[model samples]
Target: MSRIGKKPVPLPAGVTATISGQSIEVKGPKGTLSFKATDDVTLTQEEGAVAVQPRGTSKRARQQWGMSRSMVENLVTGVTQGFKKELDITGVGYRATMQGNVLKLALGYSHDVNYEPPAGVKITTPSARNDVIVVEGIDPQQVGQVAAEIREWRGPEPYKGKGIRYRGEFIFRKEGKKK
Candidate 1:
């Protein structure tokens, strides 16, 4: 049996969940989200909770059942409380600003980089140096993807440890050679 799949997902207040066909949809105060169920997994939305069942005893089916259930649970929680990703900018002259849902970043490069926040994703700056960028959304997948894309704009350098980085992330600094 799959431990994760065996657990029932609790529905938060003000959130509604529905299972239709092969997809599950969740609507909450934040927004609406949906996920497709795998072939080997079955979803049943009961009274105030969601349950997952594996179709067969096969290894793959059992594995997918747990994953699908966890995914569904995440969707429900995301729509209710939302998710966030924080990144810090390092290096002189590196900064970020929000202009009408667009994030413009200066990363000590020749040109400036701009990122347009997707629907339901909010970006905010808490400091003048643009060292802090907070990305918020109801969908964890989307929020994480956006943060990753932004980080890719200017990855951290091993020599100087400069660039955009996630909060609590540790970057191993490489030492310079002495000739």
Candidate 2:
């Protein structure tokens, strides 16, 4: 038995969930999101919570059971509180700025890197700190993907540890060659 799958996802106040056939739609103050589950798992709503159950005793059904439950929980959290990711620029001249939904990054490159966030995601560089970039969106996956794509442009190096990285991330330092 899956411990996580056994627990029902509770709906917070002002949030409503509707299960129709193999699709589930959740609406809240932030926005509306829908997910289609596979036939291996069944979705149901009871009282103020949503539940997921496996259709059969097959291994595939068991796998989908827990995954479906987590997906449903993420939907609730996404609509209610949303998701956010923070990126920190570290270097002598590394910086980030936002202009009309476009993120301009300077990572010691010859040309500035212009990144345009997708429709639902917003990227912002706080005025107080140009080195910090904030990614916010109702979808957690999109927020994380945008942050990762930005970091991929200039990942932190082992020697200097200078580049774009997630906040609170640790970069292992390497010693320089002997003269």
Candidate 3:
């Protein structure tokens, strides 16, 4: 039995879900989201909760069962509370700023880097120094992907720990070379 699949996904107040064939749609205050599950899994709603079960005992079916349930749960949470990711910029000349929809970044390079987030995702610099950035979206995956893309511009190096990194991320320091 799949433990994650067995747990029912409870619908919070003001959230609604609908099942059509293999696809499920969730609507809440934030927005509406939908997911299509594989044929190996069965999705059903009962008593204001959603449930997923394997159509057969095969390994593929069991795998889809848990995955489907998680997708549904993520939709519910997304429409209700949404998701967010934070990034921290570190270095002597590293900085970030937002001009309209464009994100301007300076990371010790000869030229500044400008980034535009995809649809449905919002990026903002909350501090005047433009060192901290916040990415917000209804989909957790999109929010995380955007944050990763921004961090990729200047990954943290062990020496001096200069670069862009996710909040709370740790960079191991290295010793300086002997003179």
Candidate 4:
């Protein structure tokens, strides 16, 4: 049996969940989010909680059971608290600034990189720190994807560690060649 699937997702106050067929929709103060489960799993709404169970004893069904449960949980959390990701720029001339909804980045490139966030996501460069970038959205996947895309533009190098990276990420240092 799947331990995570067995536990029902509790609905917090001011949050409501509706399950129809194989899909579940959750609405909260922040926003509304929906998730569709595979046919191998069954979704149900109980008293102040949601539950997931496999349709059969097959391995795929069991896997879907746990996955569906987690998806439902994420939906609840997304609508209630939303998600956020922070990136740090490291270099002598690297910096980030927000112009309206667009993000302007200077990573020692010949031209500034202009990034426009998608409809549901928001990108900002805090005035206190121009080297820090903040990504926020109701969907955890979108927030993480945007942060990853920003990091991909200038990944940290092993020698100088100059690039964009997650705020708490660690970069392994490498020694320089002998003179």
Q: Model 1: which ten-residue window has the lowest total lDDT?
A: 125-134
Candidate 1 segments exceeding 4 Å error: none
lDDT of each: 0.90, 0.93, 0.94, 0.92
**lDDT per residue as tens, model 3, 60-143:** 999998889999999999999999999999988799999999999999989999999999999999998889999999999899
- Candidate 1 lDDT over 23-136, as tens digits, reads 999899888899998889888988899898988899989999889988988898888788999999999989999888789999877988989988889999988766889999
Q: Rank the candidates by TM-score, best first.
A: 2, 4, 3, 1
Q: How many residue pairs collide in each prediction? A: 0, 0, 0, 0
Task: State candidate 1's TM-score.
Answer: 0.95
TM-score of 3: 0.96
| Consecutive 10-residue window with the lowest summed lDDT within model 3 | 85-94
After superposing candidate 3, which stretches have Cα over 4 Å from the reference?
none
**Preferred candidate (lDDT higher): 1 or 3:** 3
**lDDT value for candidate 3?**
0.94
